[model samples]
Each structure stands twice: as structure tokens, then as C-alpha cells.
Target chain A: MRPYLYIAKVRMLSALAYRFDVLSSIVIQCLAVIASCFFWIAAYGNQQAALGVTRDQMLTYTVMSSTLACLLTMNVENRIAASVQKGSVALDLLKPVNIFGIYLWEDIGSVAIAFLQNAVPLLLIGALFIVAPVPASAAHFLLFILSAAFSYMINWLIAALFGMWSFRIVRIFPLLCMKGHMIRLLSGSVIPLWFFPQWLQTVLSFLPFRYIYQLPLSVYIGILSPRETAAQMGIQFIWILLLGCLFFEIKKGVTRHLLVQGG
Target chain B: MPLIKVNDLVKEYTVIKKGKGLKGALKSLLHKEKEILRAVNHISFSIQHGEIVGYIGPNGAGKSTTVKMLSGILSPTSGEILIDGLSPQKDRKRVVQNLGVVFGQRSQLNWDLRLGESFELLKRIYRIDDRQYQENLAMMDAILEIHKFIHTPVRQLSLGQRMRGDLAAAMLHSPQVLFLDEPTIGLDVDGKQAIRKFVKEINRLKQTTVILTTHDLGDIQELCSRLIIISEGTIVEDGSLSDLIDRIAPYRILHVELYEEAELPIHPLAEKIRQDGTAAVYRFDKKKVTAAQLIEDLSCFCKMKDFRLEEARIEDIIRAAYHKKEKLEGV
Candidate 1:
């Protein structure tokens, strides 16, 4: 346990080494937050009733979505794929530690960095200038944090699933991009699922993507009461349990035939 | 007991056979043809404690494959590997506790972190206590002179510096058995000498058993007391370097330069192989005639200005072994 925490610490230091890169990404995410705010406000178009969610609530959803996007989707797939291509992952195996465990700890480091560097800033700016923030209560904020933690786990499991495919596939860029776009579209980050057509909403319900970003944002905007939030948390836990099992199974199979390619 | 043991180890990989061009690629996509590559095949050897044995082979002769299996990086398809009385496949964690591995082409250190920071991370990962970690770092720094660049990031370090850093990292845990795959590869003469000194000191002081795989003959000559040569996934030669040379090429060449041009002398134990101007070269079996005796017989018949004896070169013997010469095969 201490060793894994040290790995997380090292990863955080590694991320901090590229301070310029993190700062630049923050700038881009901030721009995205502003653009999303304008787009949603324009869509509301002075209408008091938009899908029964006020313009203020929609704007709040936009702010939470931006934060959730940065917090959850870290693109750990690209880093894993590159390491596979370099054959450096073999070194990771030499240690007594589990390979996936290291990746999880590393992702936690990255998520923490991303949250502190990007998400927190966006939430502060959005709450200050972009929109007047209102949480249903202090308990809702606490529940949102719990839901967001679950969302991060779901996002990591999904990214790891894609990352493991690089062991077999030569080109993982297209697959990675597809995952990004699919997550953005289905997670209601691009547009809240409340406005989606009935059939599309039905299809999105089957996926765990929305639970990662959309549900957490919904909880933040007070769209769900305490009872609904509690029930959604239960559903999120189920997804976490199922995906965790699947991820470990796939990882076991992958490592059994572990082939370190390239040099 | 041998510190490391292997019996008929084998590793096979199935690779897809891809064709060239558009039509061939399309056809291959429809019907996949797979080929099995026997990376390591039925090789066996054992090493006692405190021995630096060189594992040498030509390219793709399964040197790395064997090391990978022994180090628990790759599993063998069939065979048994016992490192210090434990099977690497079945008792990997226990075996790994007593093993250290280094690969020349790649490093285990984190690239973005400082050298000391990387070591600290490894210290935690390996669970080295504070006192032990500090002692190991001091020992490594003394030998590697790593203190000068310990604060530098791994990516920023020169190749030699990084290699030293890698070597130091591998030794922090002080495993009983060390597997080095080209540890001195791509280093300058001084860098190579530093590594050689480190390996020697570690083995001498700690009784560490080292299995080194390298193409560098200098490393073999200066460090290893034993050599294991493999080719085509089989052990072609395994013994002391001198014994290998003696078995493969038993004769030594004697060159003599006379004061003046004279008729080549005939002696019972030597055969004149070359004669040019006033110089003559003879190939003689050392078992039949000693160098001193042959020179004494030659000086009795003629005046000799200069003379020298040359044994078989190691490079030639290894090349001959690789080619599977009829007499040298299975020797």
C-alpha cells in the first residue's frame, strides 16, 4: 500500500515536471468553458422554460460538465500505448507490483493534478463570473463529490480497457479518438441528455459513459432530489463493481500472454 | 547447489505473416498465416555462486529470450528454471526477491524525475528501509560517481550517466543473482571499465552470481571466467575461454625472421606454413612441440633475427563455433 502511494507521489512529481504543458492545457480548458457557456446560453435564447431546466441551471450544468470532463478523461490510453510501443512496460513487470495497480495509482496522480490545475479553476471562474452558482444544499455538494469519485473510477476502467488493446493493435490513435468522441457525445458533455431524442436517450442509458460525467453534473445542478441522488449512487456503484471485475479479468488475460514489442 | 539452474528451457512465439503491397495485404487479411518462432530452444546451463559467466550469441540467437525467462519477464513454453531453489514461473514473487535485472536498451527509471528521486521511488517500491537505502546509495555513488548528477533528470543525463544510474538502481536491493543484458553496450572505454569494476567489486565483496549477455568480447575477456555461446537457439559452446580456444584451434603459429635468406629448416614437430623473403612462419601443435623447444631446434640450424608465437584469436574461434564446424560442433 505504501509502495503504491509512493508511485502516485512519483507520478505527481513527473506530471509537475511539465509545468508548461499543464498550464497550456488549463488555458485551453478555460477557453472551452467560456465557449460552452456561450453556446448553452444562446441555445436557451431568452426562454424561461427549456426542457423544464432554467437557463441558470443549464449554465451550471455546463460549468460542472467542463470540470467533470477534465477530472475524468485523462487519455491514459495514449501514454500506455506509447509505452507499449517503446517496450518500456516490460520494466514495470520486473517489479513485484502489479502493472494495473501502478497504472491506477498513476492515474490518480494525474487526475489529482488535472483537478487542481484545471477543474478547480474552471469551477471557480464559472461560479464567480459565468453564472451565479446555487447548490440545492450542502449535502448535495457532498453527494456530488461521491458521485464524481465513482465517475472517475468508471472513466479509468474504460480507458484501461482501450489501453490494453494496444498490445494487439498496431494503431490505437483512431480507437482512442473514437473513445473520446463517444464519451463526449454520450456523457451529455456536448449537450445535456435531457434534450436528446427519446430513442437516443434510451440507447445512452445502457452505457456507463453518462454516469461518469452527466449524472454527476446533474447531481450538482439539483436536477435530482436526495432520493434520486441516493438511487443513482447505488446504480453508479453497480457499474463500478461490474466494470472493475471486467477490467481485472481483461488485465489478467492480457498479462498472461504479455508480449513486449519494439525494442 | 548452483545459484541458477535451467533444464531444457524453451519459448515459442506465434507471429502473423503479413504480405507486401495492396493485393497481398488484402489477401493476408482474409487468410491469416501464422509462423512459430522458436526464440529459445532446449538450452540448459547452471552457475555457481560468485561466478561471472558471459552469455554470448549472435543476433537473434535467443540470448535475450533466455535472460527474459530467467528474470521472469517472459514465460517459457516448456522447461524448468530454478533460481536459488525456486521456480521462476511458479514462485515469481519469491524468486524476484532474490533477482535483479538490467537491460541495456531500456531503463527502469522514470524519465521525468531526478536521479535521486527515481532511486527514492525504487527504494519505496522495493521496500528498502531507510538505513539500507542510504547505505546502498552511498556505495553506488562511491563506485559510479553518481553524486555529481544525482539531481539531474534522467532524460537530461548523458548515455553513460544514465547507464550508471541504471546499474545503481538494479543493485539497490542487493539480489543474490543479477542478469545483465548488454549492460556495457554503447559506452565509451572508460564507461565500460567503470561497469567492469562495479561488476567485479559486487561479485567479489557480496558473492553475487552474475549472468551477463553481451556482444562485447572485451567484457567477456576482462570480466567473465566462463563463457556460454549459443547459436540457433542451442548451446554451441560452454566452457572456459581458454579451453574453448584450445579445443577449437589447438595449434599456435611461430614466426621467425632469419639474418639472411636461407633454406627453410625442417624439424620433426613443426610444419612450415609460410615463407617469404628471409621470414618463415610455422604452425605447430603445442602438445607436440613447445615454443622454446622449437626455437632451440631452429637456432641450432640457422641464425634467427626475430621470433614470436601467436595463439588462436578468440574472435576466430567464436566465429568457427558459430558456423558449426564439424570438429568443433558439440565440443
Candidate 2:
């Protein structure tokens, strides 16, 4: 655990050297959300309180979703895939610490960066357009925070599971890119879960993807009442436990095939 | 106690072979031939503490594979490796805590970060205290001249400069054993010589055990007292430098330059193998004759203007060993 923090801090500081890349990414992602926010604001302007969602409420949902996206993303899969490909995985494995733990901390490190670069700015922008919804009360906000923590674990586990393919496949980037794009689309960042048809929304509720992006954001936006939010938090906690086991199993399976080349 | 020990180490790899052409590539998706390559086979060697041994071999000779196993990078298919009395594959973290490694082709330094920043990061990763860290930085900066580019990013440094810094970084925390795989490769003559001098100095000053694998013969000739040449996954020669040369190749090339064309050397001491106008080459065996005797015999037959003796170098002997293996296999 001590070394984990050390690696995470080092990696974060190293990443800070590339401020231009970080700044560019923030600008581009902000533009993307702003473009979608305006389009949906226009769509809600024509509706006369349809679906119990006003223009402000719809914009709030978009803002909340984007913030959650920022907190949840940090290139965890890319790091694993890269280490696997370049054979640098050997160096990490040879370290006197758990490789999975170091990577998870590194994942969290990137999310901390996104929290600064992505979540705060987008939320500020959303506040300018509409009144952003906080949790129902302090309890609801605390629950949402806990749910967000579990979401990090679940998301990392999924990425680790998929990243294991890098050991066997040559062109893993295309597959990883497709996976990331799909997760973004289905988790309600590009398209809000509220806008989806009732049946599609019900089907999506069964999948854990919503807990990471959609459910946590919805809890922030007061879409789920107190009772409903508690139930969703229970589901997220269960997913976290299950995903923890899966991440360990995938780690054991993948490292068995680790071929460390000398020089 | 032995700092490193191995028992019948073997590493086998499964590689898929895709046939040529797009059609074959498509077919490879459905079914492909899997060939097993034995990189290291039943190799067993151990090193006492503070011993610097040179591991040399031709291309595809499994030298690096053995090093990776001892360093805890790769696991053996079937064998046991104990570094400092701990199984490297089983107690990997502990093994690595006491070991350090440097690969010539792959750098451990962060490319975009400054040299001092990289050292700072490693200090934390290796858990070196501030006091020791400061001492190490000062010593390393003086030894490798790291202060020149300590503020410059790694990507901006010359290859030679980066290599010097890398050596210092690997030695930080004063790891008890160091595995250097081709550490002096691709450097100029002066750069190579500099690394050799530093390596010798460290081994003598610190008593740090060093296992070096390299294609460069100079590395073995200069630093190593004992050399091991492994070919086709087996050590063919393991002895002092002079002993290996004596065992493998017992021949020398003697060249003579005369004022006129003359090929008359059929004596017991020397034999003319080849002849060109005004020049002749002789093969002399020490067991059969001496260089002085061969020169004297050749001088009597032909009026010699210039003469020089050539013994089979380390590189030539290793090459001959490999070529001999290839010839026996008819490959």
C-alpha cells in the first residue's frame, strides 16, 4: 500500500509534465458536451413539460452525466494494454508490490486529474445554463459518494478483464477503443438514460454499466428518490464485490502467460 | 552462500506461424501451426556473492532468457531458480527487492521527464531514505557525470549519456546483485570503454555480483575472468577466458610478406595454407610448433620482408563453434 501511493504519485507528477495534452483534452471534451447540451436544450424548448423534464432539468442531466464520466475515466485499460504490448509489464511485475494494486492506484490517479480538468469545468458550464441538482440531502450526497467509489472499482475490474486480451492479441487497441466508445454511449454520457424509451431503460438497469455513469449521475440529479437511491446503492455495492473477484481471477489468468523477454 | 542458483532451467514458448499471403493469413485465423521453441533448455549454473561472470553466446542462444529467470522477469517452464536462497518465480517480489537489472534496448527512465526527476521517482519507488538518496545522487552524479543532463529530459540526452545515467540509476539502493543484459551495446569505442571502466570499478569497490550477457567480445575480454558460451540452449564452454579459447580452437594464422612470389613452406613446424603473389599465409599449431619456430621455418623457405602472428580471437572461436554446430546439423 505504501509503494502503491508512491507509484501513483510519481505517475501523476510525470503526467503533469504533459500539460498541453491535458489542456487540449479538457477543451475538446468541453466542446463535445457543450455541443450536445445546446442541441438537447433546443429539443426541450419545443416540449411543453413532456416526460416531466424541463429544459433546465434535461441540461442538468447532461451536466451530471458528463461529470460522472470525468470521475470514472482515467486510461486504466490503456496502461495495462501498453505494458503488455511493450514487454514493460515485466518491470512492473518484478516490482515488490502487487501489479494490479499499482495499476488500480494509477487508474485512480488519472481520475483525480480528470476530476480537476473535466468534472469541475463541465459542472460550472452546466450551472451557467441551468440550476444543477445536488443530492436530495446530505445523506443522499453521502450515499452517492459511496456509490461513486464502488463505481471506480467496478469500472477498473471491467477494464482489467478486457485488458487481459492484450496478452493474446496483436491489434488490441481497436478492440479497446470500440469497448470504450460503447461504454460511453450506453452509460448515458452521449445519450441520457432519461431520454431512452422505457423498455430500453429497464433493460439497461440490469447491466452494471449504468452504476458507473448513469445511476450515479442520476442520483446526483435527484432522479432517484431516497428509497430508490438506497436500492441502487445496494446494487452498486454488490457489483463492486463481484467485480473485485473477477479482477483477481483475470489477473491470475493473464499473468500466467506473461513472457518476459530479456533486453 | 550462493547469491544465485539454478537447477535444470528450461523455458519453452508456443509461437503461432502464419503462412504467407492474404489467403493464408485468413486461413491462419481458422487453424495455424504452433511451434514450440526451447529458448533455454536444462541449464544449471550458480554464482557466489560478488562474482562478475560474463555470459556470452550467439544470436538465439538463450543467454537473455536465463538472465530473465534469475532476475524474476520470466518464469521457467520446468526448473528451479533460487536467488539469494529464495525461489525467484515463487518469491518474485522478494527476489526483485534484492536485485536490479538493465536492458540495453529498453530504458527504465521516463522519456519526457528530466533526469533528476526520474531519480526522485525511483527513490520513492525503491524506498530509499532521504539521507541515502542524497548520498546516492551525489555519488552517481560524480561517477557518471549525471549532473550535465540531470535537468534535461531523457529523450533529449545522447544514447551514451542516457546509458551512463541508466547505470547509476540501476545501482541506486545498492542492489546486492545486478543483471546487465547487453548494457554496452551500440555505443562508440570510447563509450564502451567508459562503461567497462565503470563496471570494473563498481565490482571492485562495492563487491556487487554482476551477470553480464553481451554479443560484444570486448565486454568479456576486458571485464570477465570467467566466460560461459551457451549455444542451442546448452553451455558449450565454461572456464577461464584463455581456457575456452584453448579448448575450442588450437590454431593461429601467420601471415608473411616477401619481396617476390614464393610458396615454399612444407616443414614440420609450419605449413603454407594459401599463397598469393609476394604473400603467403601459414597455419601454426602451438602443440606442434611455436610462432618463433614457424617464423624461422618460413624465413628459411622464402625471403620474408614482413611477418605478423594472428591467434584466433574470442569472437572467431565463438563463431567457429556456431558454424561447426550448423554444419553438423546440415542447416
Please name the candidate that would achieve the greatest DockQ relative to the true structure. 1
Q: Which parts of model 2 are misplaced by more than 4 Å?
A: A46-50, A129-135, A260-263, B253-283, B287-306, B324-331
Interface DockQ of candidate 1:
0.68
Candidate 1 on B1-331: residue-level lDDT in tens? 9888999999999998988999889989899999999988899999998999999989889898888888777788999999989987667667776788889989988899999999998888888889988888888888999999999999999989999999999989888988899999999999999999999988887788999999888898989899999998999989998887778888888999999998887788999987998899998888899999999999998899999888777777888877766334321
- lDDT per residue as tens, model 1, A1-263: 99899988888898888878988998898888889899877887879668778888888888888877887856568767887777777787788777778888888887888888888888888988799566667877888889999998888888998999987775788999999998988888878887899999898888898898888888888888778888878888999999999987887677657677743
Which one is best on TM-score?
A: 1
Query: Taking the tens digit of each residue's C-alpha lDDT, what string does model 2 give over B97-172?
Result: 7787888887888787788877876776678888988887777776677888889999998999889888888888
- The lowest-lDDT stretch of 10 consecutive residues in candidate 1 chain B is B322-331
Q: Model 2's CAPRI class?
A: medium
For model 2, state the Cα shift of residue B290 in Å.
Answer: 4.9
Find the candidate with the highest lDDT and give its number: 1
| Ten contiguous residues with the weakest lDDT in model 1 chain A | A254-263
